[model samples]
Target: MYAAGLLNYSEHPMKVIIDTDAGVDDAVALFLALAAHKDPKCPFEIIGITCVLGNTGVDNVCRNVFTVLDSTGVSNIPVFRGADTPLVQPFIRGESPFFGVDGFGGVHSLPNIPVVKQERTLEKESAPLALVRLAREFQGELTVVALGPCTNLGIAINIDPNFVKNVKELYIMGGNSHGVGNIRPCVEFNFFVDPESAFVVLSAAWNQKIVMVPLETCKLAMSSMEWRKQVLGTIKSSCSISLKKGLLQRFEKDYGSWCSCDAVCMAVLLKPSIISKSSTNYCTVELQGAHTRGQVVVDHPQKTGKPHNVTIIEQIQLAELERMLLSTFHPSTFI
Candidate 1:
């Protein structure tokens, strides 16, 4: 079900700026956002996309974004190039093997690809500067959807401390919980790649209306391969043949189910009701520890005097999310 107040904002779709590192999951999130933008029922308008370093380098991110934009026929949404590495750490590369050689699950080389790149010159802007500018322009209205390392956001906050206070909210796809990890034994990939930046961004202020989608929640909320097959199989009329083919290939390679870590965060923003359970907590990233570095620590007030800074989504309404995903990615969908 859609959020109660979504329709009320139809006259002015909620303006959003997506900050991502453009990996396979990030690519799916981008496409989901594009699909949502086309839905009159979902109040979201992607104002711009900013790239940072996480899954791949900034250069590859830019190229991948351009390729998606061309394929989806989404025009005029400017994409900015941001930080190439974490704030205080050396650039970490070659970590995620699931995304394969291209960080896109190796689908770019598939035979008879229907999505063609549009011939156009690309101009770029600094990601942090773009963040600052867009925040000022849409003060109290802009919502930032962060899908990668927090470098770009931390830099923006450093440049302008009020950047966080000025924005509407931040929907972030990172961190881990329940003692699970994708990179190290205790850290998610995004936070592990740039823990310093995550620390800076997460601990910047006492209260900032941030919603975190961690690894454990993603693992349990929507991990059914049968559900994926049912949804993808029935959506042939809604998705382009190329995208459908690509997604099927991705599912096949993964042995059916895909967790959708990043895309699920995007889904929450469009329909807040997708979350069946959650908690507000004082959250911060661990900067030091031989085995626990990059782990996001959520402490209770009794343990720490600090107030809660984030709303940790511990669970989600999976069936509702599946419905939302189906509607958002249907091929007839246009942005």
Candidate 2:
């Protein structure tokens, strides 16, 4: 009983570093992780947040990150600014009408949400360097959840050749499968934003494990509009007043179905069983080609000589995922 208690104490609050571009969905992901920090079943203690350029510029990303933290009443999580552009690639800004300029769908700030004053200032160290230092500090237990372009991670790998191998694992929300793409005919937004960085991260050797939750997985695992309305309909009664108001503001301008894409990565970390189907494969990005420039080329080891370097998630349990997402937004509930 004593040994079991010790084990339970050590594992509940898993240490994590969230590297994101801080879009609307990334805000949802951050809130979910913060909520999980309070869960007894499978909590996540956020070590820090590293912001990179993707959905918006690094400045806007930083603001969005801090804004989410403030709204959630989380005061001590350090925020770090990362790479402003992809390595060896020129930045061609992709205008996301849904995400808007400020990266929170242009909603900026919501009233009625209690804002936590900044207690933890931005770290002096840059994102990539901080990642390297943190990996050494936590060694065998740090899990990095990347919700943006892979620039920061690729920089870390380049700076310290062993950086990739030192982390416990990487939960990446990028890439696509079956040649399906969200941004272009053959490219996902994250990989399209920075193909060179994506190539570096996917090609980097890892000592532990790497899980890629691509665009396809999110499309399949998204909460249907019916389910979203049914669950969010109870937000007023189920959640705290402040949290309810915050959710309402964020969801007010929704389209059909609400797929918290970035949040899916966090959910997978909180409950690994949500992923119903996955496979290990070697992935590389195309650096040239008018239409296929940023496309990801996934190669199966069984069919090719390349080594399988990443676990690509193809599908997840939809119903279970819906439950997890709902729980993620509810402060009283645990995923």
Q: What is the TM-score of each candidate against the true structure?
A: 0.87, 0.87
- Predicted model with the maximum TM-score: 1
Prediction 2 global C-alpha lDDT? 0.74
Candidate 1 per-residue C-alpha lDDT over 172-238 given as tens digits, one digit per residue, 9 for 90 to 100: 9999755578778788988888888889888876236589999888876655666666754455431
> What is the C-alpha local distance difference test score of each model?
0.75, 0.74
lDDT over C-alpha atoms for residue 297 of model 1: 87
lDDT at residue 4 of model 2 (Cα atoms)? 10
Once fitted onto the true fold, the runs of candidate 1 whose alpha carbons sit more than 4 angstroms away are 1-12, 109-113, 120-122, 233-256
User: Candidate 2, which segments miss by more than 4 Å at Cα?
Assistant: 1-13, 40-43, 233-255, 301-303, 331-335
Provide the clashing-pair count of each candidate structure: 3, 0
User: How much does candidate 1 score in TM-score?
Assistant: 0.87
* Residue pairs in collision within model 1: 238-330, 238-331, 239-331
